[model samples]
Structures are given as C-alpha cells and as structure tokens.
Target: MCVPTNAQEADTPTDTPTEAATPTTGYFDDAGNWVPPARDAAPDTDNCPQATWPPEPVSTSERAASTPDALPVTYDGPCGVSAAEGYEVPDDVLASAWLVADLDSGDVVAMKDPHGRYRPASIIKVLLALTVIDELPLDQKVAVSAESAGQEGSAAGIGEGGDYTVEDLLYGLLLSSGNDCAHALAQALGGDEMTLLKINEMAKTLGMTDTRATSYSGLDSAGMSTSAWDMGLAYRAAFDNPTFADMVDTESYEFPGFGDLPSFELWNDNKLYLNDPDGIGGKTGYTDDANHTFVGAVNHEGRRLVAVVLDTTINNDHRAWEQAQMLLHEAYGVSGSVAKLAPANTDEPETTTAAPSPAAGDDAGQEAGTAWNRWWSYAIVAGVLALAVLVTVLSLASTKKRRQRR
Candidate 1:
C-alpha cells in the first residue's frame, strides 16, 4: 500500500484514496504552513534554519486560529476517531495528541490528534533501542565514546572509558532515559549518520510514514519529530521483539561495574509499571521543546493496548498516564475494533479551548500553541542542572573512594 507522503516538518494529512480520494499535494513552509512541494513553492529543507536550544515547536492554537480554507489541515483537534460502537472515549480526556490501538490486530481503538507532529524528547530512544537490539547481540561488548559520555541530559553514569555489553546499555537506555547510553549505543552500532539510516529504515518497514529520525536520543534536534499515530506505529513494531519487551518492562537494573568501577542503578520511568496491574511497560519523554510525552502499553486478558500520548506539558506529568488509563478502560469495554484509523481530512474549524467535561458536544481540544514555553524551558534547565550535579557528585565520590582503597 502506498502511504500518502507529505513534504513538511509536520504532517499534513493527505488524501491517499488508493488513487481513490482527490490528491492533495504540498509541503509545509518554514512557518508551518502547507505549500506545494515544487522547488519554487516549498521551503528548502536543506536551507531551513535549524532550531536552536531555546526552540519553539509549532503550536496547535495558532493553527486553529488560522484561516481554515487555505490549508490542507482544516481541523485542530483529535482526528475524530473517537468512542463509537463498543468503544467509549470519555468526554474529558486530557492530551494534546493520543491514541490507543490493539497491536495484535493492527486496529485503532480510539485516537486524538493522531497526526499532530510534536516533539518526542527522549521517547525516541525506543526507536534507537529497537534498532540496536535487532543488530547487536545482548552480550556484545562496546567501549564508550567521549562524545557519548559527555552527552547532556539524563544519563546512566557510564564513565568516559566504560566498556559494557549491549544488554547493559539497553537497561540504561530504557530504564533511565539515558542520553549517554543512547549515544554509546549509537557509537557502537554506528555513528549518527548510519544509526539514523537504520532507524528511518525501521520506521519505513513499520509504516510509520509520519516519523522523521533526526536524532538517536530523541533530543530535540533540527528536524526530529513524530506524532502520536507514528509513535503508536513505532512501539507496535518494537513490542513484538522480546528483547524490547523485556527491557522496558524491567523496573530496576544494576549494571555490575567493570573491574573496580562503581556500579550504576537504573530505575524505570514507566510509572504505570507500579500503579496499574495491566501496565506492561513504556518510555517517558520530556524536553523544553517536547513537553511531557509518553509511549506506553497495557495488556488485559489476551489483548494488548498501546497508548501514545504527546505534549502533556511540564505542569501535568501524570496527565499522559491518566489519559492512557482512560483509553485502556474504554477500549476494553468497546466491542469491536477499527481495522485501522480511517481518519478523514483533518480540515475543519471545530477546535477551541473549553473546560473539559463529560459533554461530548464540547470539542475535545486544549489551547496548545506555546510548546517551548518559558516555564517548560526553566524546568528543563533545572532538571539538567540537577542531573549534572548528580553525575558530578557520584563521579567525585567514586574517585575519592577508589583512591582511598588503593
């Protein structure tokens, strides 16, 4: 099947029609506006200015407020795949973009903002993990690179010259959202260029057409992005691999230090693991640009429901989990499943900010333009400082203890 392609940083829902629907052709401009892909028409992807640290992701609020008639995107809220038939999506589900699907049958149970391309933060590590797992053996030993060890953000406290097995790195990558671990794996597997080639290849094989593999760690890079729908596709492809399942599902791991080095402890961030009995495991993501994003799964009886929630904001870290929980309950209650999401053109003007309630008539969308908001940036900065301090303190203490022992 030829999946419709859009030539933009963000997805502009296309009319695939199997040569059935009217063909819509365009790419997104630098302003996140859709334009034809013609060289004269579309913004040059090569010359597009890369986003800097104090970055800003495209906002849903601004898009909602735009003139609807000129663009391919007519709607600003959920793709309209809601509770119907036996499924029951509550009226007050809180998420910028979300989806719950049955991986067993490749069926979409329900979805919200399915195609909204948002920042993934560290969650893209799942794709990197999935790719490496397929190529490297669990016991394969790898030497950490300076570039990898010096990476910013969360880490597994791997030393500059640490040598570890693929299995150990996987534990760190999934359990701790370790940017360093992700980089080490990338260096071991291949450099950035080759690693991304593999990841994009994996995405293509899984039919995640909306995803762009711009970074190994899902750190907000120049053009890296994914949607809830795309994440649903990524995780579905990943969960099928037993290695992927085992790692994310692990609550805690101890990496035995090499020789006299200090051991590292990694705790899983998939909070659902502890609170929900049916929760299998998942990855958590956060960045000033991406806000709080998540890709999680739950298994009940014989069915597995994978839920992808993106951009829950910094203030409400639990919103994504709660939203996923609601989706699972409603999915279990729903009788049958959609063969897949048959989302119509998202061209409509119904999205508006209103108090979330049980009222189905209320458009299920929140005001969401300011993604890289000031508060979120501050939070990210604080988190980074705290993590840096943690790594530094641990390293200093370990060095002192080693000197004493010698």
Candidate 2:
C-alpha cells in the first residue's frame, strides 16, 4: 500500500470492530483546520452551495447534490445508494468521493461523488505494478541508478548501482510505497516518459476512463487524475494477475540488500490487510494535494468486493481504512446495481511492451548483474515465442512455487 514513510496506522484496531460507529462531524476553517459543529446541532450540510460536476474544494464548501443528471442515475448525487428505501449510509464517512462495488459482478453497490476528479497520490502505483508484472520478467535484475536511489518521497532503501530482482522491486513499490523502487522500475521499463505512456495505455485497456497517470510513483504531478470509479476498476483488474494479487496479499517480506544497503523487513501497510481477516489486499496513498486515498478488496459471505476512497482526511477518530470498513459493511447485504464497471476493451491495440534490456556486449556490460545477463540472453533465444506467452508461463510457474512454499 502507498503511504508517506513517517505516517503510522495508529487508529487501526488490532482486531476488526464489530460495530460501525459514526465519528464527529466537523468542517475545515479558513486556515484549513477542522472545526467540529456545535453540540447536538444538526450537521451543517448547507455550509455552502451544492456539489457540481467539477467539485469545489471541500475546505470551502458544503457537499449537497446539484448534478442529479450525472451518469449512473443511482450514483448521480452527492450521497448515493442502491439499496432499498430508508437505507442510510454511515453518517461519519468523510471522503470527498468514495465507491463500493462487487468484484465478481462489477456491480456498484453504493457511492458518493463517484466520478469526482481528484489527485490519486500513491495509489496510482497499482497501475504501475500491473504494468511491470506484464512487461518485465520477475527474476530479471535491475541495476539501480542514482536517479532512482534518491527519489523524493518514501523509499524502499534500494542503493545506487545495486542489482535487484524485478519481483523484489515490486514488493518495495507496493509494501513500502517506495518512490525509489518505482523510479528504478520505470527506468527498467524504458524511463519516465515511456513508462507514463505505457501506464496510461494500460489504464485505457482496463477501461479506467477517468485515470491519466503523470508519474509512475503516483506523486502529485500536473494533470495526474483518477476517480473513485476508476480506482475500483484498477483493483478489480488486479485480482486477475497472480503476481500482483500475491504481492498485495503478502503482509510482510524480507526485502533484500544490495551494494552498501543492508537487508530490512518490509510490512504491508494497507490498513485493511493488517486489521481485517476478510480483507484480501489493497493500495494506499497520500499527498498534500491528494490528501489520503485508498483502494481495498474484501471477501465477505462468498462475495468479493472492492472499495475506493479519495480526498479524505485523518481525524483523531477515523482513518481511510475505517471509513472503508463502514462503507463495506453497509454494502454487504445491498442488492442493486447503480452502475457497473466497464469490461476491458479488447480491440484496443496492445502498445505497452518491455524495453529490450541491453546485452553484455553493449554499454550495460559493466553494470549488468550475471542473472540479468543470463535472463537477457535467454529472452533473445526465446524471441520466436510471443512475449505474452512467455510472461504468462513464467508468472504461472512463479506463482505456483510461491503457493507451494506456503
């Protein structure tokens, strides 16, 4: 899951709570500080004008519905529901936009401003991981460059000039929200520009119409955008990839060391993974501009469900995970489809491919690890077979080995 390195899951309960309790309702002041309403007073839902297509910042406005004609009629309002009459969503939900959907059926159970545009923060790493798993071989080693080693935000501690397996880098990307690991993977995929090109291509393939990635690390960037609906699509697509599924589901791993770096343990920081037995996996993210964003899945009563929360805040009483749990709980027995996730468009031409790793005879000979050299040569020898088939075969075998080991 993606998060700033210094943040802690202090609000996450060691055990899942049996009841969903609403937290205190508050408003942000002129200085962007939270101000609770008067005691026993009605929530000031009318503090500002109604919500519109391009929602106004929550710090300055009330969130009532003004766009009732929006797509997916059931979810066209500020607070949406697909349940029976009198069904009230948890009053404490604080996200500017959120969604809960059935993974298997692609049925959207409930939502609030489902299509509101927002910054994705680090949760966009989900797209990056999916791209890496598809294009690069897991066992292939990448030599970390200084650019990747000194990435700006959270890090997985990969050292410059160190050799790391693609699989391990992926672990760092998801488990630790490592911007450094993300950059290294982006370079291996052909550098920042090409990687963004491929990731946006993948987003289109998966029918994530509202997403446009600007950086592989999911840090705030110009034009980086995603919606709650799009994040739901991302997590749903992720369930089909065994490697992606396995990595997110893993709670802890012994991340390897290289060069002067020492080995350190990495733990899955997705609050759902840590606190709920039913939570399968998820991604987390945060940025000053994006606030806190989360995408998570759960297995409940034989049904698989995914939830997304965007542009939320962390008060003393609740975190993003807690809001997700409340939404998922409200969603379990509900049985109506306000909307459906679009299936991938197969006719879209597949354009994202792994960049050819340089061979030993090339400039890469000095820095390429022995394993990387071997893999590169083997890839050349197996060029007769389609790239898709080779990656599928290797991924299946690797997943089998991982499962068997457990």
Candidate 3:
C-alpha cells in the first residue's frame, strides 16, 4: 500500500490573507523590489490567500559563474592573478610602451606596443655612456670643449675650457643626466660624429632594429627615436657594466672644482631612488614631443622588473609609477618571476661582448687609444647628424609650402 509522504501535505496553507491584508510570509512583490518573508511568516501553499512578502533574492553565487569577484580565487602556486589590489591601469595612459625580462634571468615578461617608435629621451645616454666608457679611460683628463660647455639644459656646472677626469663626467652624466656631461664625453671620445656612430653601432649590436640616435645628450633633436623594446635591450647591455650601473644608482655626488671654481653638488633626477627602496635605477625625460617619459627598474622579493613608459601627459609621474607597479605585479603573477637580460646573440656580428674595462697605464697611450676609439665611433654620429639635417630641411620646406598656400 502507498502511504502519503509529508511532501504531499506540505502544499496545504495554514492561513489566508484578507482584503485588508496584514503581511504574512510567502512570495510577494513589494512594488518591484523582492521582499523576503519575515521569520514568523507561513510558507506559500497551493490553496490559500496570496502572501504579502516576496521571495528571497538570488545570491551572486547562484547567478552567472562568469562574473568576476564572485568569490576569492585560489591557485596552487605563485603563478596566478596579482595579489596586490586597487591598481587599475587606464588603457589610454601611454600612447606607446614596453616591458621585459628580469634583470637576472634575461627573460622577456610583457610588452605593450614593444616595437613602436618613440623618443628615447635621456635614456639614449645609456648607450652613449657605454660607448664613452669603452673608448675613454676613466682617469684620463678631458678638456671641456666650447660645444660641450655651451650645452643648454641640465648642466653639471662644468666650466668650458676646464679639464675634468672621465670618471667625474661619467658620474655627472648618469646621476645628473647632464647635457653638458654628454657633450663633453662625446667630444672627449670621438667628437660629435664618432660618438653618435658608437651609439648606433651599439644599437645594432644589441639588436635594436628600430632605434636611431641624433645626439649624445638626448636633447630635442629631430628623428631621435627608439622603440621601448630597443631601450630595454640597451638597458640590458649597459646593466652588465658595474661602473655604469653604479653611476645610475648613485643618489648624490660632489664634483671637485677646477682653478678658482667652487666645488659643486649633484643629485640624481630619478625620483624612484628617493621614493622606492627597491629601485635599482631609472631615467626621466620630458619634451614637447616626448612628453613625460620614464624607464625604471624595481626589485620585488627576489625578482627584478623593468618598466618603460613613454608619451605620458605632463605631471603624471605618480600615474606612470602606478602603471609600472601594476604591470610588474601582473608579470610577476603570470611568470612567478621578473625581468632578466637577453643572451648575447652570437649570430649578429655587430653585437660585441661588453667593452673591457680600461687599465690604468701611460697617459699618452691612453689618450691615443681614446682618440683611435673615437675615430671608429663616427658611424652613429653621422647617422644622427643626417637625421638632424633631414628634420631641419623638412621643417623649412613645410614652412615655405604653408606660406605659399596662404
């Protein structure tokens, strides 16, 4: 015999609602809003007056599973979404940018428009420094040329016609990002032409296929462009040099004066050195064309991340840093690692092993060596000079055409 289970009788209602209904429990809509039944209300039944209270709202968990932040996600290892929250980078912040490889392992991490051409700004000095150090002995004295001393922006307070050791100028160049230092170093190495040649040669050697340099100082010169990836490549190449790395990392320096000049103090322009304890080093740049630009590296935990931001709007340094930190956190999450330098591509003939450190020796031999090295460094300089000329001619031609149209 079949016996009726409680489920069969559960549909029976205990109470019914009157015309002037007092609210009892069950499903009911309160003016379009779902109102859950009070604890004391009776359950809905098949036969009875309609209840006043609405049914319970659906929980997010009961809704679509594809929605983000429905629940805390977990992964077995470090390879997962970034744990650091509250960093939402805007998509349109920088027109062009790129990031790559940990400082240690040389593995490329992430790239945003990596190959896009943009102004290198002061970052160009990384290559210039490499060329200068390779060609000039650190202890050798270089007389400041009129061209170098006359450099317009961010001077190291170096006087024209006075002599400074290669070491002091290198420090001035990296720490202060001085245009004067760059020109002095260029003149000391290969004059203008050879200095630029060495920079271009180094670019070629490093596989910077899209990079072009028009000046050693990275002053606003026409057609002075390089891709973010190319800058990263240049950084990787320069990082191996202990002196170069040390120079960039320095917080402050005191330059000994010459003749009647007083000693001068210089501080690093990179804000990261002061703000971030893990900041290894960085460079900052700004021009009407380049806008606010920065290339910085941070060491988090055991990993190192390098970030390059270009063409950002003015007064957005904080935003730039935020974006960089977010990208680094994401890269760290994805790879469970940070940036590393790429291995030297032996297949490329232009790529040479890092220049050997100069040995302290005879002053004449060193000067001769420096001069000879400069002579060989003219190719990049010529390339940059040509670019400058091209830019000037184009500007003039455009002006003339506009006048004719008017």
Candidate 4:
C-alpha cells in the first residue's frame, strides 16, 4: 500500500450517487483541470456514451448461489457461491471491498463485497500501462505534449517538449504513480478517449466484468471504476507480459533527462515489495472517492496469490496491506474444509451460504457449480516428491543415530 505520500486521500467519495456520464466535452488539462474542445471542435469518440460513472445499481436475485452478476461471467468459481470457504479470514479487515484469489486454480479463495464497484484511483494506471506496452514500442521516444506537461497530481515531471522513451514512461506510470505519465502514454496510444475505450475493451476481453475506464489517470473526476475482483483479474492478465512483470517488480528506476525535462529517480509507491518476502509487486491507488485501494500479487510457499483491497481506512497503519498480509499468510496454510458463502449479486451486498468445506472423503464439494476445473495435478506431483524427499532425509538421519549408538 501507499505511504502518506500519495495525495487525493479523503473519506469515501460522495459524488455521483447516481450514474455520472463520461465527459464528452473535454479531458483534464495540465493542472488536472477539465479542458473542453473548441465550440466547433468535433466531439471526441464517445466509446462508452451509454455507460455512466458510479454505475447505477441494478436489482439482483435473493438467492446467493444464483445471484445474477455476483461475479464476472469469466470468473472460475460458481456464479453465486461464497468464495471465502476453505480459508481462515483475517481480523479487522478494514476494506469494504477485497479479494484473495488463487491464480493457478483460478479460484477466488476469499472475498468481501467483491463485486462492489468503486473508484479505482491510480490503479487505473496499470491498465493504461498494459495498453501502451502492447501497442507502443518502449524504445520509441515520445514528445511530451501540452496536455501531458499540464497534467496534475503525482507526476513524472515531464516538461513541455521533454521526449522520453515508452520504457521510462511505463516506469513512471507504475512506480511513481505518475498522472502525467498516464497522460503521455494515453496520448501516445491515441488520446485519452480512445485509450479509455481500449481499457474498457481489454477489460471486456479479460473478463473483468465490473471495471469501466473513463479516465487514463484515476482522478475521481474522470470517473474510473472497478470492483476488487475485477482488479485482481486485470492484474493477473497484466502480469502475463514480461515487461509489465519487470517494471512492476523493480524497486526504483533512474530516468535519463531529455530535452527540457531533467533526469529524476522514481520509486515504487507500494511498500508491499519492501516489507513482504512473498510480495510479487503491484500498484497503489488513492482518491477522495476511492480512499486507499491496492491490487498486488505474491508467491507464498510456492503458491501464487493475488489480492485486491478497496476503500480501506486512510490512516490505520496501511490497513489494506496489513489485511492482505494476514490473509495471504492464512491462505497458504488453509485447509479445503471451510464453508463458503453464496456470492452476492452485482447490485446488492447481501450474503448467502454454501455447503461446508469439503471433507477428506468429499470428492464433489465446491467444484460443482463453476465453469473452471481445479488445476491441482502439478501441485499434487510436487507435494508427493517433497514428501518422499523429507522421508528419505529422516531415514538417513535415523541411520546415522543408529550407527552412533552402535
């Protein structure tokens, strides 16, 4: 999670209690001010004109198991089943929306308000980075446009006409959480409107059902939103790229000055990398509307886990990270016996129950209702080999003791 360094920290956002439309008139200027196109200027492509901000909540079914849209159709677990079964839950988990998922199994191990759509803040930058990394060449130098130089919030400090490589901009976007870096990349990828469209398109393709990208930078005003589950899915997709993995995992980067922009060092905003041995690195996000949001991955005891925490407390010892750490620690050792809750509907926060966690003899428990199959063959093989090795070691040690006794 982020230190007090990130600005835009405030209580949960109250704006757009109803659906807020994506602004077609203009985008944010250098000062992070909204700039409209000229009176006769052609309207920017309104890719998501029908979509509105803080998407209007829809009605859902009363049953948890059959709860419609409880999770994105692409998620592996049962549509309406509680994902938290078979795991020990963390205490005082301050996040209003969070998820802990098994990437290898594609199983959402645990969640709370997983489908609640909330402002994403800088977390939006990750999608922007992925989009750019795919479309633009990292070695290509992009000239900082007026809009980019004028961008506000945490910035890469790109001055007007400062030309930087796509590589540096990505580093700035992910590590520094640079709003200006987001703008530069978005512009490079064909302006903010098109980039937002690309973001949503990728979200659709990746099966990230609740994410809507209206802003390149995650300004609360830009109306970017996603659920905790959506973020975990998005991050999982991003990590597939070697470039993204390299950049996000980097602790710090040294940017070479170009043109009017002087060289500067950028450090990752997330402390999870520095503090947690298992942390695989991810991004941090914050805004008045989003509060403290984070999406990260970790390798715990050889198991890959991705976690998302949204709307966590602002000043409580990085509650999001702490909660994630505690949860990951438990997840590594959890038995497959805890009962699960039914999945809540997309539009509601209600809960339902699932059958108790499977017993040793239970061959057909939680895997019955989902679209995905468990991919535990590799794990089983590895486990067996490890056990065999442990037995051999003990046998050898016992023989040594026996010899000494003789």
Candidate 5:
C-alpha cells in the first residue's frame, strides 16, 4: 500500500474530502423514524421542510363557518329548559303566579307575574302570627272576650271569659286557619280596625309594598291584595319565627280545655302541607270572588322556596305544589318528589261562615220599588193616609172651638 500519511494528518480530513459532513441529530420526525441526510455531511432535504412542519392554525371564525357549534350544556333548577316549558295548569285556573327562590343564595329561580296583585285568603294568618309574636309574649294569658270568642267563622271555641295562652291561639291560627284565633289575637293586640292598621304598618316596614291586609281573617274585601313578590317577603319573615312555622306544619293539635267540647284537632287546609318536598307550611283561601289562593314554602334542597298562587279555579294548593316541584327539578336538579297530602274527611262538613248580611235599611231600599205598577200605588197610599190624618186633626180642633164658644 502507498505510504500512509502521518496519524495526525489522517485523522484531520482534508477540505477536499471524499465524503460530505453529516447533519446534526434532532428530535424524532412525525413518522417517528430517524431521518438521515442525503449527503453524509449536509443538512437533510428529502423530508418535509422544517419551517413547513407546523402549519398555520385555522381561525375560530373559519372553523365555525365550516361546522355548527355543539349543543349548550344542561342547567338544573328553575332556570332550566323544563321550567321554560311551563307546568300544566287547568284552563279555568286564572292568573297562576309563582316565585321559587334559593334561601341561602337569594337566587330567584322562577317567577311568573311575581308582582301581580291578588287576594290572599287565610294566608293572612301568617302575617298576623308574625305580628303577634313580635308584639306580645308567647306565654301571656289572654282572657277570651265576647269579641274573640264570638267571631263568626271556624271558631277555636275559646268561649267568652275563657283564657288561653298566646301560644295556644297561635297554634289555632296556624294549624286550623281559625278565623276566631285571628280575631282573638287581633282583639288582644288592638281593638277593631286598629288591628288591620297595625298589619298594614308592619307590612310596610317589611318592605312589602304590594302587600295589604284589610281584615285579619283575609276575608274578601275592597283593597285587600298581595303580590307573589310581597307574599315571598311575608313568607321569609314568617319563616324567621320558629313557632309560627312549627304551628303551620303541625298535622294536628289539641287545646288544653277543649277536650269535652268539640276537640280542637285541626287539619291543615293547605293541600300542599305534606305533598311538597321539604314543605314547611302554608295557607289556602277560596271565595266566589277570589276563586282560590295559596301561599306556601318548600325547602328547595338546602334552599328555601316560597310560592304564591292566586285566582286559580282549580285547587291552587295542588297546582302550586306541582309547579314548585317542576321548578326545583328543572332549575336546581332537585327531585320533584312529593308525599301524599292528607285528604279531608267527607263526613266532616266543610265549615264556612255565611257572608255578612246587609243592614235592614239597605235591604228595604233595594226592595222598595217593584215593576208591577207598585211605585204609583205606594205613593197614592201614602198621600191618602196623610189627608186622613189632617182631616182628623181639623175635626178635633173644630170641636174644641165650639166648646169654647158655648
């Protein structure tokens, strides 16, 4: 062999080399195969250009134009799609109003004409109880007067001259929806009319602008109206009174003295009493004028919800319970489960007071004139009677003058 160059000269290859320099190694390529350079000592050119490996990203607007967006995420509670579908209410049910609020979060889940004013029947007792609890001592004994005992409808039979603790009356008022209890409490607190004044004042102080009470019993009257919003406020205030809430939720209660007379066992008139999930208590009202009214509360999971249904032809307590359940299920993922509401016994006659009768003078005025030609006949009869009386008096005077002349 030709004489080999010195070892140092052989190791340091000449610039005019027989083989090219290799490319530096880098991370693996997209195919996961190590790519070698075409020239042993040069950069690679067979693979994709290094600059073009990461292509420019497409814009969001372009992607959206090519494909539709995905469906919206599911939401629970009164704000969900199910609530938007609306609950089924009877055709005759006029103006069903409701509001479902989370007590802890103060979030209003559902509202249907929340500010619309409608009659509140025995539901007024809730506020009355609040007033009593706030103003008087619970254990204080109030002597039942004729005014309280003689109250017309649904009496607790706390007879005149009898005595009961305020607590007892509160139970009667809430559990039984007793008109007498309301009257007794009103009279105990303030005399006639003043009770209503106090209720109105208290409502105002509570910021219930649309709430008004003309009677403690919630009887039909002019200017007696409350909105769902105002009722919610009232419910919130009432719930603060543990005694008031406990009394309303109680299924039955017996007074101390009334065992011999008709037992004071009271059944809640609110049909939603047991049926509503987490239902605390409620009240109901009905009349020829105010068809049906309800104000009640349900604990929406850990949240407190108050619902008010007014002017419904159907049993509003049931309808309100259903609507509330739907709202809770749809908006907050609460299960719309319900317990059976206790039914009233058919044997027990539904007790209601007759509407107050008009005064005798008012009745007489209404019946004064008949269409059978009676008006002229009555006028003629009156004129003849007057003439007869005048002639009799003149004849007596003439006899007196003759006697004097003689």
Candidate 6:
C-alpha cells in the first residue's frame, strides 16, 4: 500500500472537511474528516517489521520464546474486528498496532496487530519510572549534569549546577515528559548502561517479552522496540506502584529552582489525563520513526481499562490520546477476548533496590543486588506474584478462561 507522504498533526474535530487546492491521499470518514492514508493501511514492513515467532531476544536468557500466531489468533489480522463479529472498530485510529484491555481482569477486550513491533517513543519512560520508583528515595538529591541539562528534546527546565530531588524529577519526567529528567534519573539508578539493563529486566518481569529498551527516554535507537501488547502489560503493571500511579495522575507540579534558574510549574502533557473525567492517567510520545505512541488508562463503571497505540500518525480526526479514548469507549462493553494479557513475572531477581554501586563496564550479566527493598517486595512484587499464581490456578481450573468467537 502506498502511504501518504504528507501527514499533519491531528486537529480538533470539525463538522466538515477542509478544502484545499492540492488533493489529499486519503478518504474522508462518515464525519467528513479527511482521514490520512496511514490510518487505513498497514505500515510498510520495510520500515516496521511484523511480530514473527521467536523474535530476536535482546537478552541472552534461556526463557521460552513467545508463542507464535501473535499470542491470540484473533489479533493476527492486519485489519478486522477482533472484539466480536458485529463490533465496530473506529475507522480513524491511525495506529499500526493498538490494544484495549481490562487492567484489572487482564482480558484483551479489543485489538489489532497487538504484537507488532514498533518504536515506543517516550512511553518507554513508564518502564524507567517503574525501575527506579522502588530503588531511589524521593527525597534523594541530584546534581544536574551537563549531559542531562543539554538533552536534545522536551526539557523539564533542569540546569547544570542545579540541585533537584527525585520527587522533583519524577514530576518533570511524567508531567512534562522531560528527556532531561530521564537522563538525570538514569544516572541516579546507576548509569545509562545499568539503568537500561534494569529497565529491560522490569519489562521481563511484566511479561513484556516483545519489548527492549535501548534508550533512557524512548528516543529512537538502533534496536529499541516495543509492541501494543507489551505496552499494555507494562502500563497495567505500573499502576501497582502507588508512586508511579500518582505521578501520572498529577496535573501540575512546582519544580524548585536552583542557582540562576527560577522556580517554574510544569503541566501534565497527557491530554487524556487532563481532559477525561474518568481518565486515571497516561503517557504520550512521538519521534520521527515512532510517529505517535501512547499508553493510558481510564476507569469506566468501576473497571479500569488500559489502551496502547503504536506507530500512529495524527490526523484532523484524532490525536494519539483521542484514539486511545475511542478504544477505551469501545472496550467498555466488550466481552470477547483475543487472549488475556500474560501475568507479571515474579521470579525476576532483585536488581534495582541495592545493586552493587555503579561500576565500570556494567551489563546484564552483572550480579543482582543482594538486598531487596522490603517495601517493594511486599507492596509490588509480592502482590504481583500472588496475582500471577491466582491467574495460573484459575486458568488450570477453567479451560474457558479466554473467550472464543462463536
């Protein structure tokens, strides 16, 4: 399929399509909005590879390869309804891969190309946040280094010679989507190399086998990648940590000024979190290669639902968050499933809490910290393990845990 060469960021919805002298490449929707070609077509495989079985693992660990056919057969299609026979998926989703799943029940309510590997952009920050949330103390102070202060995109206003706390940086990281904050936080977690290792380990613990973090802030890296399915798993697991959950929900934070810099307030960049009443929280990201990526959660009728969209282009009809809102709306009443999200892995060695002090040439092969944070163990890991065990027992008891098309 020929993709549109000229794609513009999404604009607010309108009753009529815009007229122009030059013709556009895509067809308008029922609302008369000019949907872009990228929204309606599968991504060019030359740019985005399909999620094949036994994909190249980033780590050399001996774990089993992810099941083929893209986990659940229903989600194997490039374009079709996986929710149910008559369910209508929104036509303007603009994503190459997307998923809507129940965060609490783990049921994959709706999806398309759920396991397609694509760049995650800044949504990968959620993984970094989870990795260090238990490892670093909120009050611990950091001296902003020149590297962090000079980060390329979307700075949180940190300056060299400035002193900030983990809490302050957390605000910048989530609310502002600060790349500078990510770098500073990575340094605190050991260093870039050690932090990436820990972040990938966290991905494994959450059963996100399709994800591999090569950058601290989700920037495009040679081998960095994630999928809609893996993103859903990571987001769902992130909510288990109260600190992460609260940070994403916070709308505004007052970051303290240091040295010659003046104190300034940072606003949350997640439109879903800012707009929807039921919106619990979410993260948004974009890069040239990633286009637009998002992972967000909403509470509807007491059920928490999470949506992930990867490799999307914004159109006049919807932005990444708007597409996510559409998915969540369609999922509220969905009863069928392609497959339940895999439960979090509890056997991950404790590597973040008290790992050996940051040393030279650190890699994944290094030994994990001997001392595990009791709070994280009891609060996060223990709870996740119990849930995993419960899911296993239930699955063993009932063969029909996952729904099939009639």
Per-model TM against the reference = 0.64, 0.67, 0.59, 0.65, 0.56, 0.69
Ten-residue stretch with the least lDDT total in model 4: 36-45
Q: lDDT score, residue 275, model 1?
A: 76
C-alpha RMSD by candidate, in order: 28.6, 22.2, 29.0, 18.4, 35.1, 18.9
Instruction: Summarize candidate 3's per-residue lDDT along 1-406 as a digit string, tens digits.
Output: 2211111001112232333433333222322221122222112222211111111112121132222221111111121111123333344344345564566656656554444556665777888889887888999998887777777656677887676899999888877777888888888776889888888898888867656776676654544667665777777767767887888788888886766997878888677655778777877664434434577777778777677765443222334455555455555554532223342354322111124434557787788888888977897799899999999999999999999999
lDDT of 4 by residue, 175-231 (tens): 878887888888888887899899888877766666766667777543356877678
Candidate 2 overall lDDT versus native: 0.70
User: How high a TM-score does candidate 1 get?
Assistant: 0.64
lDDT of 4: 0.63
TM-score of 4: 0.65
Q: Indicate the worst ten consecutive residues by lDDT in candidate 3.
A: 3-12
- Indicate which candidate wins on TM-score: 6
Model 6: how far residue 237 lies from native, Å: 0.6
- In the range 1-406, model 1's lDDT, one tens digit per residue, is 2222211111322221122222233334343333221121112112212111112443332222322121123223334445447776654454566788887766777666566566677778878888888899999988987787777767777776676889998898888787878888888777888999998887767655456767778765555556776788778878888999988888789875655787866778677765788888988776545656777788888788888877553222234567667677778866564436322222321122212333434343222323436669889999999999999999999999999999
Q: At residue 109, give the lDDT of candidate 3.
A: 64
Expressed as tens digits, the lDDT of each residue in 1-406 for candidate 2 is: 2222222122112221222322244333333333322222112222212232323332211122232232221123343333333335776667777888888887777766565667787889998999999999999999898889988767888888776899999999998888889999999999999999999999888777567776678765555677887788888889868899889899998988877677879889888878988888888886645667788888988898888988766553667788788888777778775666654344322111112345537765546666687899889878856787989999999999999999
lDDT of 6 by residue, 267-357 (tens): 8888998898899898888654566788889988898989998876675558789988888887767676655776434433211212335
CA lDDT, every prediction? Answer: 0.64, 0.70, 0.59, 0.63, 0.54, 0.71
Number of the candidate with higher TM-score, 5 or 6: 6
lDDT of 5 by residue, 295-358 (tens): 6677655666656665443222234345444444444553232111111122321111112334
Q: What is the lDDT of residue 326 in candidate 2?
A: 80
Per lDDT, what order, best first? 6, 2, 1, 4, 3, 5
